[model samples]
Structure formats: C-alpha cells, structure tokens
Target: MTYKPATQDQLLAIRANAGIAELAQSERYAAAEPDLVEAIVEGVGQFAAGEWAPLNRIGDLEGAKLENGVVRLPDGFEAAYQAYVEQGWNAIAGSAEHGGQGLPFTLACNVLENLGTANMALNLLPMLSVGAIEALEAHGTDAQKETYLPDLVSGAWSGTMNLTEPQAGSDVGALRTTAHLIEEGEHAGKYRIKGQKIYITWGEHDLAANIIHLVLARLPDAPEGSRGISLFLVPKYHLKDDGTPGARNDVRCVSLEHKLGINASPTCVMSYGDNDECIGELVGAENRGLAAMFTMMNNARINVGSQGVQIAERATQAAVAYALDRVQSARAGAEDRSPVAISEHPDVRRMLLRMRSLTEAMRGLLYYTAGQVDRGDIGEPQAKARAEVLVPMLKAWATDTGIEVASLGIQVHGGMGFVEETGAAQHWRDSRIAPIYEGTNGIQAADLVTRKLGLEDGEALQNLFADIARAAADEPQLMALAGECAAIAKWMREEASLDDRLAGSVPYTAMCAVAVSAWCLMQQYDALDDSNDADRKHAKRVTMRYFLDHIVPEAIGLKASATAGAALLYELDSSVLAA
Candidate 1:
C-alpha cells in the first residue's frame, strides 16, 4: 500500500487551530511563515514516504546488530540517516543561535508524525536527539553547548538519554551510577562516571560520527534518592585539543535487547567507565539531575505522544488499504451477490471508522499540545502552565489510544493481521512500548493528578476547564461533554485524600484527554471553509459528530472510575493477586 501524508486541508486546519499565524507575530517565531510551514510539512511527508517507508520492513527483519562490542543499524538505515542529515532536517526546529532553522515545534511534530509513520524505529534516533538538544540548550554550561550543540543540531552527532538502570528503572533515585571528581588528569575538574544504564534507545549506533549521552548519576557527597542525582554530558569519544573527535571514551554498549518491536532501533545496556576513564561534565548543578533530566523527559513525553499519533495513522491507512483490496463475504443486504471487498461489510467499516476517528482525535490533541509548547516559548506564562498540565494527559491517553487503535487495525485484518507478512502485527508490537516509555502511563496519570493539579494552586486546571467550556458554549454538541469533564475536575479537586485521587488518576487523565480532543476537533470544525472544499468541510463535521457520539461518552465511564476511590483497589491483597 502506498503511504499517504496528511492532506493539505488537514495541515492547514491544524495550523489555523494551533494559531501558527498569530505565533509568527511573536518575537520567538518571527521567521515563521504559513507558506514555508506548509512547504516544510509537505516536503517532510514526501521525504519520509520515499526514503524511510520502503525500509520499514527491511529494518524490522534485519534489526540492529551488536557484533563484538559495536552496534550496527539495520540495512539502509545508515544511508537514510545520512540523507536526512544532508537535507538539514535535524536543524528545522532547533534554535537559530545554534545553527538551527528556528521553526516552531508544531512543524517538528508534523515532521515527526510523518517520519514515525514511515518508519518508527529509524525515527527514534532523531527523536532522542531532539530531547537531548532541549536538555542541553536549557541546562548545559556554555562550554558544553558550544562543544556539542552544532554537531548535534547538524545531525553529525546523535544523542541519548541514560536514566534507566537495571535497579533503578523509573525510580531514578535508586540509580547506582556514580560520578567522582577527577583532580589529577587531563580531564581534571570533570567527573569520572562509572556504572551502567539500560534501555537506552539508539544508545550505541554507527549512524553518526559521535553519540552524546545525557547521563543521570550521583555525586559522592550528594544526598540519597532523587534529590541527590545529577546530570552529566558524557560523549562517546573524548574531544581532542582542537575540538575534533579523538580517543574513545570508556562507554560501550555491553549488549542489545531483543525486543518485541522497534527492532531497527538499538536498545542497549550501556556500561560506563569499565576502564575507569569515562569523563563527564556536570549539567545544571549538583544533586539536581532529576530537575535537569525533566527538561528532556518532558520534551520526550510530548514527542512520544506524537509517536502514538504516528503509528495510529500508519495502521489506519494500512487497514483501510487492505480492506479495499482484500475480497471477502458479500454484503448483508445482498442475497445472491458475489463476495465483495470486506470494506463493503458493516463491521469492517465500523472498525475502520473507529481507527480513523481516534487517529484524527489524537492528531488534534497532539498538535494542540505542541502549539501550547510553542506559545510558551514566546513568553506566555499561562500557555506554559497549561502545557505542563496537559503533557501528562497527552502522553498517557494518546499512547493508550494508539495501542487501542493499532489493535483495532489488527482485528480489521482478521487472520492476516496476526501473521508477520501482512505488517499489521508489527504496528501493534511497535505501539506496545509507547505507554511504557518516557514514564509509564500509570506514572503519567499519577503526575497529572498529584503534581499537575497543584499548578497555580489548581488555577491551571481551572483555566483549562474554563477554556473547554468557552469553546463548547457556542456549539451545542460539545456542551454536555464539557460539563461532564468540568464536574469530574471539580470532584477531583475536592477529593482530599492523596490515595483517593491517585486511584482515580488514570481515568481522570483520560477524561481530560477526551474533553481536550473534542475541543480541538470543534476548532477544526469551526475553521473549516465550506466554499473552498465543501466536501472536505462536510467530512470534518461528520467526523467530529461521530467522535462526539461514539467516543465522547467514554468520559462518563471514565468519570465513574475516577470517583470510585481507593477502597476496592486495596481490597485485594498481594497474596490474593498472586493466587
């Protein structure tokens, strides 16, 4: 099946909904123009379909290989990556001060969506690099940024985040990795990092000239737990006197994980300072690694949400294509009719509609969230706060929905989806990890309920509800959904017990996602032009109505779950669970 990029109408609607034109007037995005943004997204879509889509199956089959301590990417990955770099795609959304094209993050999200749909595993390399760029740009010292930013932004060097250890996982405070000050060597004043990091995506690969690792470790006198952790910039190869790549660093990929999906992306168990020579420079301050890491983590969480949208788009497209091509049973109304395309079957149509609607909803939610980030960059304090509150929901719900949509795509294919040759199964496998990465969905829910709700003493969430209410006030179709969400938010706010709030967090988060998605879809509906493309505008309205009718009601059950309290949850003991 031929991969299709987001249509011009969809991109324009997203831009209008995201207020890209208004943002362009701001000092931060003065260089941004509507035409240029459209061109960029279109070019990205074309490039991805042409360069990366063809390699998706090959990447899955060949995977990443670890031979004698070196990591080699699947066939075509290296060449494709080089072409990507040469095209200056990596610099599109980077800061102009650091050799970037200075585009808004919304455009970046669009690019990522296209790339991820084309080839998720290959897309991960740049995804991690963007996170690292954000981290270093925010927290790295002047020297560190000068040394790394240009190459990283230029895609000559790639980056990775090293936070997970076998013993630590999400409990970053439990990390055993330690960094001690080096007082007597050429790298004096820097720290010598020693220990291991696991689940490092694109951790060790030959795709770039260098790999910069943003590592979280503990200092000697640092306090125990998360409060004591510190961030470090550890390069794969130490820099020479002239700032060129020199001798190898002490970091190495011990082994690669055999995973259920994303086989082309190397997930490595990285060993640092095995030879006692891994030198790392501190980023931000000592005992503040978690804070610095959040800079990257938050960025990654947003991108990860986009990944969900990406896979859903791909699966939906593939499923629709298969349904149109594969002949099956006759329509229910036709008695003596020959077997028609399964798309002619009502159940298959339902599945395809479910997949398409959810994917559209997710895209709306993600693009809106990305717009918030862009707004925040332009000195909007309220926008920044709203973004912080929405990030967790975006990450958790979008990913969960991605998995659900992919599963539906598989079901639409019936027996064919279960087999590897059809490729539907791969989308399911690839999507399975999104909920677990960048912090598990459970953690995201917990963060949304506990931490995000506390923003501005709860004013942030209140503003969010108010905006949804305002958006729905003129549209009768959305008012009920908006009211339900507001009521849930009110109940959550009044719930005093931490455990009670935590128990209901996941559902509450999901409810918020549905509400926001509905609001975004309405925005698209309002912005649609009947004169230019009447059919497309009508289709948008129909999709919005379908989403509200079929999917928005999910908020009701989710609300019930949110207010269900912690009693029933704890009623089952560990022994009972084990049994």
Candidate 2:
C-alpha cells in the first residue's frame, strides 16, 4: 500500500500530545494574534503541492542569469512569485499593524517548510525580506517602518541583508565598508555608502521593482573593529514619496557567483558606492550594526534551518516514490524472472524508512522550536527564557539533520542518485549549504557550549535535561531514548574540558539534532496515542519507534566524540591539512 502523509486531523491530534495546542493557546500566541494553526497547516500542504515543489528542477536547471548588471529569474518564477505574493505569504509572521496576516512563528515555520520543499532558491528572496522586516520592526524608526513595511509585506518590493565584505567573512570587525554622512543639504542625515559586499543572495534582482538592502558600514569617526560598524537601508532604486521606484540607486551588481547550488537565486558581488552618492538611512543607533543584524541573522538562521527540512522532506518523498517503482533484484521467496521493487530489499527499505523518519522528526523539531519562539515573544518570563535558550539548539539540529536526511535519500537511489536528472543529487547539493551557512553548525555548537550551557547559573541546561527526563519518566516506551537525549545534552555541557570546541562542534551539533529530534518525536507519539485519531496515532508511534531505535543511538556515539573534545582537529597542522 502507498503511504500518505498522516491527515491534518491526525497531525493535529499528534501535535496536541506534543504540547503544540497548549502552546498555541498560551498568552504569547494570543498576543501575537497568530492565525489559527489549522489554517496554517492547510495552507502549507496546498502550497507545497500546488505552487512550490514543481519548480525545484525547473529553477535549478534554468537558474537566474546575470546580464548587463541585472539578474533574470528562471522561467515560471515570476508567475509563481506572483501567486505567492497574492496569497499574502510574505507577511505571514509580520506584525498586524503592517497589513500582515499576523501569524505566529510556528505557523510561519510550517509555511517555510513547504516553501523549501517546493523551491528553496525561488523562496530565498521572500525569506530574506521577512528577516529584514523583522529587523526593521525591531529597530527602525516609525518613519522607516511606515515607508517600507507595506511594500515589503505586499511583495511589491524585496529585501536583503548585506553583511560580508572581502576581508570580513565571519569576522565582522574586519569589515572596511564606509558610510559617510552626505554633506549636501538635500541628502543630509542620509549616509553615502561605499564598499563591496560579496556572496549576497538576492542582492540584485528584477523579481520585484525595488530591492531594499540592509547594509553594514563604518562611519568616518567611528571606533575600529566591530564597534565601528553601523547598519543602513540602501534600496536598489530610489523610490518616490508615492512608493514607486524612481532613479537607480548607486548600488549595482558587479557579478554573480557561480555556486554549487541555488543557481536560480542570484548570489551577487554588490558594489555599494561606485557612484559616490548611494544614499542610505541609519538602521539603529550608531556602532550597533552586529547587534541589530543579529535580529535579522538569527531569524534567517532559523529560516535556513527550515529550508534544510524542506529539502530533506522532498528528497525523502522522491526517494520513496522511486524505491517503490524501481525494479531490482528479487526479495526472499521471489523467482529470478520476478524482480521486486527496490523497496522490497531490506537495506533499501532501511535507508528509505530512516530518511522518512528523520525528515518527520526534523519537521516536528522545527515546529516545536517555532512554538517556543511564539512563547518567548508572549509567554511569561520563564517561558521567554526557555525559548531564548532553545533557539541555537533548534537551528543547529534541524539544519544538520537536513544534510543527513538528504544524503540518505541519495543513498537510497544507488548510482542513479548522483545523476542530476534524478533530482536526488540536487537535494544533496542544496543541503550542503545548510550546515555551512546560517552561522555554521560549528558556530552553533560553540554557542551551545559557551553561552547556553552556563545560562541561569547552569540551571537552564539542567532544566532542558529535566524536561526530557520528565517526558521519559512516566512513559516506559520513551525512557531509553529520552535517557540518551539527556546524556548527550549533559555531554554538551561538559565539552568545555576538551580543547578547541569549534573543531568537533559540527558533529556534536548533528548529534544534538538527532537526540533532540527523537525527544520531540517521542512527544508526537505521546500526542497521537492520546488522541482519538487512530491512523495518526499508529503512524506517530511507528515513526517515533523507528527514530528512537535507529537514530537515537547515532547521538550516543556523537556524545562520546564530543566528550573527546576538539583537540584532535586542532592537532592537524594547517600545512598538513592543505596537503
């Protein structure tokens, strides 16, 4: 029998057991005026199938092209983008006052997963725009918000975050971009930015009439290093008071990067001040660019994590479809002339099932994390604290799992996986960026160790362990898996004794992701079993058991290595590494 996604009613019942419903009804959710959870889920399923998924290969093969300093999107992207804008998807999590749908983070995540599953490259522009919106909402003046929010939310305009410079890849302090105050009275109070930004996604595109670039630069008199940096909003084209694009802004795309994936989304080398009059308005207080950018960066990090989930889900589905149809050697009791589907083979079945289970667990973790984000914004002080602490964990684990799951999908296809036409390879290539981007999984693990571990005088880490303990304590079925999760979390706290936390951090991040995902899956199992929806209940239990038995042990090994510390990687000489 063909396997279908558990129905919405069943998913909701499963979610309820995972504490999703209670979280939705919490004060924080109410305050956000977040859309009903059911609507969000329904919208996601429809959008994934109807709008996004069909574009994956089309966008990948016919990616955006750079011509005469302008970017041209793939065929059908404009129409698909139009459909997305019309649906008001750009503003799902935007503040209500800005003509947004005012949905919660959890709902927004649901949509993002679908978007990623459909076409990650196409959705990059909107993803960046929403992060910019959040940054502006958090820090921009009323005048700026009044001027930019409506167009941004309506998708009449798009946005990008410009943070990297030639000398400053990960180190913000090394940036040399300069933002001098314009001397002319007409442009007074506006800064003229001059520098180059590299590897900027959606930096220069014609998908929208105007592109709003939130750039970071240093004032002439500002202090050195990171303290000297400041953020600005530099649009692609100057807009009239009526909000229509007018004269071209000095910013222009120098060239587009030929990347390993996401070719459909233009990654450009943007020159900010070639004309010497690129007008930019200050974002927040001076010398606080990194801090202000963090708001956008963190939001983007989570969104990127969701993208990883999307790719994994799509790839897993595609692999399963192929497995059940592709004929290979016969299974036990089958005759030589009667070859069975690849899925009939035990090894192939194991890989495909692992891919499905991991993808599901990842989705659950992302939604659960988003629920916490909603709570942090509106829940009590303690709830907010808990949510804040979980952000890094969620971001790290989900993205890492995305890479693993996508890779497993490729493995299920055998030799055909490497062929681009199969579409399996695309997922693997695209997923590679997830762990490397969004602050890198290593950076995420370092954060977990240095900051999050010692939070609340070491009580925060213990609280997380306690929650897992409590979840496992009463449920004998989950006790072993939950204990493993607790053990890994404990090892993460003790990783400080090892040298060079960053070296072994990525694997640790992946391990943590697996453990945490298992914990969340167990919660889903509890939810489904408690609900009246029998199919969903059975499905959740089976999936949870699959994850706990097969995936949880992966974390146990990772914990062993993380406990071994970063010294091994550090010992490898740069000369030897290069050789």
Candidate 3:
C-alpha cells in the first residue's frame, strides 16, 4: 500500500493507544510482559506476510470441494494449516494445560486481524476449532476433554458447529433431529441421532485427521420445542479406545454448497444416521443443548466480527494501493500533459481517508474491546461486567462496519472492482455472510438493546457515556461530540421497551461503536502526550482532528434520528412495494 507516513499530529495519536502503553499506564496491554507482546506481534506479522498472503487468491479460486463425503480445501490449505500448528498459532488463547500458550484473547485479537486481513476463508477452520475448544473446556466432561481437546488445541483435528437444519435455521425450536435412547437401558445413556444438518462450517473437511461435529438434537421422550434439545459429540470416524480412527461413522457429507463468499471454507449439507445407528454422546444435560451450543456461538459471533474487520482492512489496502499507482485526470491548475495518481483527486482522497478512518476506528474499537477482555483477567466484578458490555457491541459494530467499509472499497475502485480478477469484488461478496451468519446483525442489535442496554437499569451504558465524556473533557470540539453521544445514551434509557428502543437500533448501534472508538483514539492521544515519539504523536493528532471534524458529526446525526424514532423506514405503504 501507500508508504507515506501519517503527518506529525497523526503519529503522536497512535502512540497513545499502543497496547503496551495502556498496560503500563493502567490495566491495559502492559498487563502482559513487554517481551511477550513483542513476540506475539512479530509472529502475527510473519504469518500474515508469509503463509497467508500468497494463498488468498488461490483459495478463493479453488475454493472447497466435496469428494466421497469429504470436503477438500484449496491446494495450499494443508500446508498452511500445518505451518500454523508448527508456529503454535492455534494455541495462542487456549489453556496452557492443553498444550496452549495460554495468552489472553485480547493479545490474540491483533493476530486474528492479521490472519483475516491476509486471508479470511483459509482461517475459518482454525477459528471454528478455537470456538469448539472453548466450548469443550467450559462444559465438556473430563473424558470428553481428554479425548478431544489436545488434538483440537494442537490443530491436529478440526471442529464443526451443527445448529441449522432444513426446517430450522435461527429458530432452534423448529429443529426435527431426534436423539433416541439406544438399546433401551443397556446403552440407555447413549443416543442414536437421525436427521439432516445444513450450512455446517468445516463440517466434513479433509484438512485435519478427524472432524468433531457438535450436533444439537432432541431426545425421544423430551418435551417439544427448544426445551427438549440436547448437544451430542458425533465424530466423523468412530474412535477406538486408543483414540485412533477405527471405522466410518454414520454421519456423511451429502454435498457442498456453492456460495457467495469464503469459498475455501466448506458449507455442507450433512446427513446423520443413514443406517439409523449413529452413536452420539451427550454433552452437559438433555434439553440444555442450546446453552452448550451458545458457548461456541458467542465466540463465533465475535470471530465473525473480526472477519468483517479483516475484509475491510484488505479492501482498504487494495484500494489505497490501486489509487496510488493509477494515473488519472490532471489537476485543475496543472499543465495539460501532467498526470497524477488517482489518489491525488479530491473525491478519491475523501474516499480513501473515509475508508482509513472507518477501518482504523473499527480496529481501535475492536482492540479496546480486547483490552477490556484483558482487564477482565484482573479478576474484579466491575472489570468483568465492563468486558461483558463490550462483547455484543463489538460483535455487532465491527461486522456491520466491515460490510460498509468493503462496499466503500468497491466504490473507490469504480467499475474495476466489480470484475473478477481485481480481487476487490471478492471482498464484497465474502463479507456479506459475516453479518448474516454467526447470529445475524439484527440479532446482535437486539442483544445490545435487550441485554446490554438494560444492564443495571442502564448504568452500564451510563458508565460508558461517562468514559466518553472523560476522554473528550479537554477539547471543546470533541466535547461537543461527547455531549452528542451522551444525549443519545439518554434517549436509549428513555425509550420504553426493547423493541421500541431498537426501532432505529442499527444507527444507534453504529453511533455507540463510533463514539467508543473515538474515545479510545482520544485516550491514545492522552497517553502519548508525554511520549518522546514526536512524529507518531503528531500524525495521531491530525487523524483525531480529521475524525472529530468530519466523522463525529455523522454520529451526531445518527443519534438524533435514533432518538426521533423509525416511522419513515418502517411505515411505508404496501402499494409502494408493487413496483
């Protein structure tokens, strides 16, 4: 991309937000040792530049294919996954007892961004595996952990989440899959699963030795609807007592889906119990499968948000690179023969700067969310709650921003972005599913509205406003922006119910994200004020000024409209739809 450094003011602002600097100053990145920080960041940069960079286009082109009931990834996938395992990248946030490095999730967030920025599709397997590891660690039986986790954490095996069925997608209550108690009371504890599951990610892949399918089904004698559902661990191949693959299990891949994006990650239609004899072991308890699945679902949602960030970053880099090299129209006052890189144009610069601001700001927000996670590691009630409040916000905000940033990237490339070879078009298509999958963005908004908003009668949101206000207290310009955010927070509290409050929830959610991001950037500015890194601090100030001047006002308008209500968008006449 363009190599020009940020201006003096912009540079300073970034130093203020460095993870290490925050930790040293207070419960921040400094929570980890300096050498550890350096090592992790270096590893992330290397992985992104080395293995991931080259295979991006390769994976998208080759995608994932189904053969003999197995999903085959792109050409370089096995090698890349092996390399990731060798580097211990998959174990970054896993428990140390299970062959992991035991690093904080926040520490891993930057690495996640780099991986995604390098290639999102190829990284899907690892991401899903990590979530499965979390679920197993949190709720799996001791035997289950011993049998599954070492391979999963070591990246020797992969995992899949099975929640969707033909009749059931988001509504889990509609699930038809049945888990009948087998052999009466002899093998009564065990169940036989019978049903088809679709849209399962990393469902039946060849990238790893064995695929663990976490299937949710209902017991024969259990109550109807969601209350009767139970989680089962159904392996692709039955494991011998020695933990080796013995024979084929009853589960099989019926087909692979041809999708819009993330082509390298197989979205499968899986059939369970073709012979009506799939042995399935229970996880947690019967009728509590939804709760168990949630452990994986929540992590997946956050990872999906990171996916959005990754695509946006890639799109921005591509746009910036293209703009800097492509020569276009002459300047208004220049000689007739003179030409300039497209970036020199006013509109192009605006789009580029806007893309940069949103991307950086979103990254800043995500990292801050990570930092909160780190802070939660300190083991305090308030710290834990603070981290909880940010999770849903981060999940919703970053993914939505991903969609917006990627679309803007397409705009920057003009018509070329729509074509196949440019690589810009693929980002747009790939990012579309992030919001829809991993709990739709609408679900995220509802979560923020219903759960996060009402925390302690809105005290959590109130405290959030206080933090924003504190960050902007020194500058009059930013103070106005902070006040606007605070006013919106007030409106949120005044709104009657969850549904009513979320009437304009999309913009309101965006407003919260952008406001918090600006706060983080401002905090970075505060931290760097005393630093010797003059250039870094200067660039930061300019960037911050630009954000406050050009960007914060839009958030102001969003807050106003969110407070106003959503009749216009919702109340349109049915006759208008006929056209």
* lDDT of model 2, residue 244: 81
Q: For residues 438-525, what per-residue lDDT tens digits would candidate 3 score against the true structure?
A: 7777777777766777677767777877778777776565566666655666666675444456776777777777777787767766
Global lDDT of each candidate: 0.88, 0.75, 0.75
RMSD of each: 1.4, 3.0, 3.5
Name the best candidate (by TM-score).
1
* Cα error of candidate 2 at position 496, Å: 3.5
Q: Write one digit per residue (lDDT tens) for candidate 2, span 124-180.
A: 878889888988998999999999998898787899989888888878789989998
Off by over 4 Å in 2: 1-14, 17-20, 23-28, 31-35, 333-337, 474-500, 530-533, 570-573, 576-579
Question: What's the lDDT of the predicted structure labeled candidate 1?
Answer: 0.88
Question: In candidate 1, what are the lDDT values of residues 1-579, reduced to their tens digit?
Answer: 678887564485457557888888988788778788878888989999999999998888899999999988777888999999999899988988899999888878787888999999999999999988999999988888898999999999999999999987888899999999998868889999999999999999889999999999999888989999999999999999888889999999999999999999999999999998899999999998899888878778989998889899999999999999999877898886899999989999888988888888888888888888899988899999989988998999999999998999899899999999989999999999999999999999999888888799888888888888887776554666667666766677785478888898898888889888888888887777545888878877877887888888767567678888899889999899999
Where does candidate 1 stray beyond 4 Å?
474-477
Per-prediction TM-score, please?
0.98, 0.92, 0.91
Residue pairs clashing, model 1: none
Off by over 4 Å in 3: 1-31, 183-188, 335-337, 475-495, 530-533, 566-579
Put the candidates in TM-score order, highest first.
1, 2, 3
Question: What lDDT does model 3 reach?
Answer: 0.75
